[model samples]
Target: MTMNERIVQPQALLSLIALRDRALQAESLNALAFSMANDLYPVLHFHQALVFAQRGEALELLCVSGLSKPSEDSPYLVWLRRASRWVASQLPDQQPHWLARDAVEPPAEIAEGWAEWWPAGLWCVPLQRHDGQRLGLLLFLLEQPPAEGLQQALSGLWQTWAYCWAALTRQRRLRRWWPSRRQALLALAVAGALLLIPVRQTALAPAEIVSHQAQIISSPIDGVVERMQVRPNQPVEAGTPLFSLNETTLRSRAEVLSKEVAVADAELMAASQRAFDNPQSKGELTLLNGRALQRRAELAAVEAQLKRTQVLSPRAGVAVFSDPNDWLGKPVVTGERILLVADPAQPVMLIQLPVADAIALEPGAAVTLFLTAYPLQPLKGEILETSYQAKASDDGVVAYRLLASVEGKPEHARLGLHGTAKLYGERVLLGYYLLRRPLAALRAWTGW
Candidate 1:
């Protein structure tokens, strides 16, 4: 009689025939589900409703209108469940449809007067498949009751919805597995790359390697370097003869002086005899005697000069030749230096300190040295002398010179074996380097 009656009246006859056709040749659910949700949105007063092809009871809530979900424990689900149970009982032989309180078959008074007299027109009818799966609910919330044609449409598509839900579940399972697998592979590749790379660093300290000042010796005398008595690096005691000059010229002069001395002795004897003979000749005799005596003294002076030909050592220790010893036959002039000897018992390490450290050091301050040749060994020494003034280096950096002594003949330690000595007068943690020092310097320089 009404539009609702027009939609629902033919459901019993039409649904039975449609079910048989679906059982015989079933299809995927997409078309049938779209028809249902599209038709239902207008009837239900809903803004949006998307049908999902998920198997079993995965969908949590049923909203007949807007986005409102009626909970499972609520009276709406109980009413829907009762209706579904009644429909499932007469399932194969009967068709599913919304029933009033006075249905001829299994009757359902569920959602009675839903839009007839109720304030909000809400009701739900559960749909089921022949295979005993809950296919979801047919939502019906409307301002007006459904047309009789609507029940025939709902009953027509249970089988198609079941097949589509199974497919969706399978796709969901696949999607969940892929992303984690991709991320795991990326992490493993990064770890492998890090392991293959290597790191290296310098083995030597930068500040420790530097050069200092030293001296060279030269020849001082005029005669030929007749012989070199000392070998290179050989130790010598103080006043030892390092080399000797030829004594030929001085020896000849001494022989002449000896003849003069003999003549003077005879002359002096004659003068004394004359004086004894004649008292009047005493003054002349005295003058002759004085001349002979003075001549004798000059002869003694010449003899002494001959003894100085042999060269003598000036100091005690090892000798380093300034030039090749093969040139020993070459002549040298007066005041020329032949060799030098130093104290072998104590050897010193010299370090050039930077301007800041140099200014801090004073004589008698303690220091320590560590040589590369004896890497694990440390030697103790003192600052015996410090340059009171600063000298600028070739790079324009100013520095002061420091000296430290090695304790013993260190194994593998030799003169000119390169090494370093730490001249520590202030205490600072080794970790604090550029930061603490540079900021302090900046502050001082800027007067900030």
Candidate 2:
């Protein structure tokens, strides 16, 4: 049917007005075109809708509706692909126009395919803003010519819908792109102010409860452990037997030395009598006296070794050691460390600050210890002393040793209790406090 043969009804404007409202409310250009397609379904009698957005010199497909998705190699899809670029260039005047298969010519490459599968008619509406800027194109493909009333209704609202679509496109572009200069400057100012806020600089390290004046129990003489008198963590008094070394060899050596001392005394006494009888024997008596004195000194040394056989606690405290079986059969050399008998009354926090995380620590610096057993109740303390050099800790981590004395003596505080310590240093900006390590790492990586 020809365009002149069709007639438009006067009441069709009401339906067109309702459709325009729906299109205006859409969030994006794609949604507006999709909604328009659905609203015009009964009116225009179209089978498929295609929406495209203009990008530089090309028209990019944004949305498609009404028809089932065609296969990649379908003849209809092949025709559409071949014709999209030609259709984009045809709408140069930013006006809505209809194309008839009889009037428009197809490209030579897909001419046969278009003739076989293409729709009978296509209406192209250029989406243009109020300022006449062409945003994109919307196409409705029909199997046959639409009624005159539907055609006139679509023509009347097409420009209004274009303006709505153009507005939607502008809103979307603004959201997707970067912020304006003013917005960026405002954000940077807020961040700078936050970074300038002062905060306490703190360093975290692994810590444990240790004795301030722990008495070390060492082996005075080399001997095998015969027995352990005190259990680990057991309370003990001064002079309490901690562990005993084998005394059998020491007692025998002392007895032999005693016998030699008696023999030397008898020889010296006989020599003295002879010296009195004869003046020539006086030199022999002096030599005998010297020998006796040497023997007596040897006996005293042996006796001293016998006395050290029984290891005793030097001060009254808790016996801090591992398993009792560990010390039972252990042989130790002279001056070898046996165990520690820590005075529970004087407890200090021993911090193991890892070498990688070490910070400048001074005496009396604030320290907060959070014991594993008593995690909620943090104990307050201050740095007492720090080792001059780093040493290997129990867990094989190279750490600096730091001693801190807790302020209040809590009843639950016990020696050997493990905890974490947060040592506070000088105040610094919040940015430095948070990014201190990251900055250090970046500097090391860049070497500047």
* C-alpha lDDT values of all predictions: 0.53, 0.80
User: Candidate 1's error at 374, in angstroms?
Assistant: 5.3
After TM-score superposition, the amount by which residue 447's alpha carbon in candidate 2 deviates from its true location, in angstroms, is: 5.3
Candidate 1, residue 388: lDDT: 67
What are the per-model numbers of colliding residue pairs? 24, 0
In model 2, the number of clashes is: 0
TM-score to true structure, per model: 0.40, 0.62
Least well predicted 10-residue stretch by lDDT in candidate 1:
201-210
RMSD of each: 25.9, 8.0
Taking all chains together, the TM-score of candidate 1 against the true structure is 0.40
